[model samples]
Every structure is written in structure tokens, then in C-alpha cells.
Target: TDLNWPEEPIYKEYREAIKAKYQIDRLMKKRPNSRISIFAKIQAAEENLAQSQAGENNSDFDEEIPF
Candidate 1:
């Protein structure tokens, strides 16, 4: 069975949305004395970190399983 799958529209939409959100957050950070913007950037960074960690964990788990 082929494990490769084509990318779906929903996934593309999600990727685009994440990219746009991050860009907005990045621009917000450039504004001095913008506490609200800073907070938003921090939140976005934390969310990205959590997602990265989860992906790493899943990859490790996959490697541990005997095929």
C-alpha cells in the first residue's frame, strides 16, 4: 500500500492561514510599546513550538514501532 497521499485543500487552507497569522504577528512585534501585539506574538510562537514538539514526538514514536 502506498502511504503517500496528495495534499488536500483543507490542509492548504490551514497552511496559508497559519502563515498569514504568523506574518501579522511578526509585523505587530515591530511596533514599540505595543503590549497587546507582543502578547499575540508570544502566543503564536508558543503555539508553533507546541505543534513542532508534537510532530517530533509522533515521528519518534513511529520510528520505535517495528515494521
Candidate 2:
């Protein structure tokens, strides 16, 4: 019996990071009155996501949870 659960997405760390990056980018784009330009934020997010995907930093960003 293989103890490793290949079917579980959570078992893959990169998947979780990608999911978080997508959610953060989506939220950042939705803010209407943010101090920084939406385009800038998006660009920053892209860079951050790239860094994360490269197995660098994995910092958590603020995301709104739908109730």
C-alpha cells in the first residue's frame, strides 16, 4: 500500500501556492479605491507568483472569504 496520497491536491505544495496567488490577484483587481494603481498591483502579483512558483517565497496575502 502506498502511503503517499497522490489524489489529494493539498499534498502538492505548489498547487496550494498557485491557488493562493490566483485568489490574491483576483481580490487585488476588485478593489476600486486602492492607493496603488490596479495595473501595478497586478504586475506585482505576477512577479510574486512567479517567485513563489520558482520555490522562493510563499508569503500569505489578504483575501476576502465569502460568507
Candidate 3:
């Protein structure tokens, strides 16, 4: 099916409100003192460390902005 699209941005507030509601729903579902396995914690830590190291390595390279 062919679709007609808006040339300018639209439904900005509706989109943001939907995102906010999703975040609120996610936060409400999270339990305090949730149990996580030690191995899972280690894996998460390793992933975070890897991401930070990757970012640090990329810091030497400059990124170009379209604007």
C-alpha cells in the first residue's frame, strides 16, 4: 500500500507521552530487592566494562555530524 507522509514532524507530544508511559510501566514492574544470580552480575559487569573500553578507544577518533 502507498502511504502519504508529513513533510514536517508531527505527533511529537503523543509520541513522547507514549514513551513516558512505557518507562513508567517498566519502573512500576521492577521489584525492590530483586534477586539476581552472582554469575549474571559478573556478566553484566563484564559487558559494561567492555562498552566503556570500546568508548575510550573510540575517543581518539573524531565523529562527523551531518548538521
Candidate 4:
């Protein structure tokens, strides 16, 4: 039997980091106060989220596989 348990802390931290990165990216954009700049921030956040999630998923996969 397989159990799907969510790692709340890891997930929460990942989300928070993404949010903060987005905010910082926005502030660094060509027009910091523009709506279009927010899109850039979102893109940056998405990349960061993907990397973080990939790392977490890889660790989980490793834990499940036996050598």
C-alpha cells in the first residue's frame, strides 16, 4: 500500500520563498511599479518553484527506490 502524505512545512516554505522572490524580481524589473513587471516576477517565481519542487520530488523518489 502506498500513502500520499503532504510535507506541509516544505510546501509552505517553498510557496513563501516563491512569493518573496517574485516581489524582489518585480522590484528589479525595468518598471518596478508597472503591472507588466509583475508578470516578469511571476515568471521568475515559477522557475524558482519548479526548481524547488523538482528537488523535493527527486528526494522523495530516491527514498522510495531501493538500491
Candidate 5:
């Protein structure tokens, strides 16, 4: 996984997301913003959202829940 990127769309999607996340995390360090931090804060938010929406909740970003 480190040396090669798979041809599947799932791999491509994850790769892009992780790349963007790292880029944003680096940016947040160089230019700190109180409004948002894309690292741990976002992860925490995602967890919270997941728990809160464990019911019949609808979202515009109807992404699949990871395994």
C-alpha cells in the first residue's frame, strides 16, 4: 500500500482523501485557524456524527460508512 496505489476506485478515493487530509493538517500547523482543524478535530466530529445519526437520519453527503 505504501509503494503502490491500486487501480480500483475505492483505493483511489481513499488515497485522494488521505492526501488531502495530510495536506490540510500541514497547512493547519503553518497557519492555525480557530474555525477548523482537519486532523483530530475532524475525526472526533465524524465519530460524534456517526453516533448521533445511528437512527433514520438523512444527509446530503450520503457517503458509505467504512467497514
Candidate 6:
């Protein structure tokens, strides 16, 4: 339990390699991966969609060609 596992899956490879290199030959398969839930991902996507929609509707900026 002294190992500091990463919260992201991308870091899992590095973590596993490090564990293998330093661990006392213990299996890492039983270890749990920390990550965000699917609901969180969905909520973030929804928020992004709303922001994009709002930006599209509020396009009061100049459309002039800066050639």
C-alpha cells in the first residue's frame, strides 16, 4: 500500500513498471485503478455542449476578413 497509484489510466503503465521494478515480486493485478466515474464524464460533456451552444448563439464579434 506504499505505492502511490495514479488517478489516471494513462499513468497506469508507468506505475506498473515502477511497481514491477521496486515491488517485492507481488502481483499488481489485484490493485485497483483510481478514476472518474462515467456519470462525471457525461456531466462534463453536457457542460461542454451547453457552453459551445451558448458561444454559437452569442457570436457578436466582427466577421471581417483580416487579409
- Estimate TM-scores for all models: 0.41, 0.30, 0.36, 0.39, 0.27, 0.36
- The prediction achieving the highest lDDT against the true structure is 1
lDDT of each: 0.75, 0.66, 0.67, 0.72, 0.69, 0.67
Output the better candidate (1/2) by lDDT.
1
Error of model 4, residue 17, in angstroms: 43
Question: Over the stretch 1-67, how does candidate 2's per-residue lDDT look in tens digits?
Answer: 2335456565557666665867866776767656558778999999998987766334433344454
**Local error of candidate 4 at 38, Å?**
0.3
Worst 10 residues of 3 by lDDT: 1-10
Model 2 scores a TM of 0.30
lDDT of candidate model 5 versus the reference: 0.69
Off by over 4 Å in 4: 1-33, 61-67
Tens digit of per-residue lDDT, candidate 6, span 1-67 = 5366557664667766776787834544334322345667888999999999899778955565465
**What is the C-alpha local distance difference test score of candidate 4?**
0.72
At residue 46, candidate 4 shows an lDDT of 100
Q: What is the Å distance of residue 46 in model 2 from its true position?
A: 0.3
Clash list (residue pairs), candidate 2: none
lDDT of 4 by residue, 1-67 (tens): 1135455544767666765867855666746467777888999999999999989977867678888
Better of 2 and 5 by TM-score: 2
Better of 4 and 6 by lDDT: 4
Model 3 lDDT tens row, 1-67: 1135456765778566665866865765664434456667989999999999999788854455444
Where does candidate 5 stray beyond 4 Å?
1-37, 55-67
lDDT by residue (tens digit), candidate 1, 1-67:
2235456544767656765867866776666668778889999999999999989977877778899
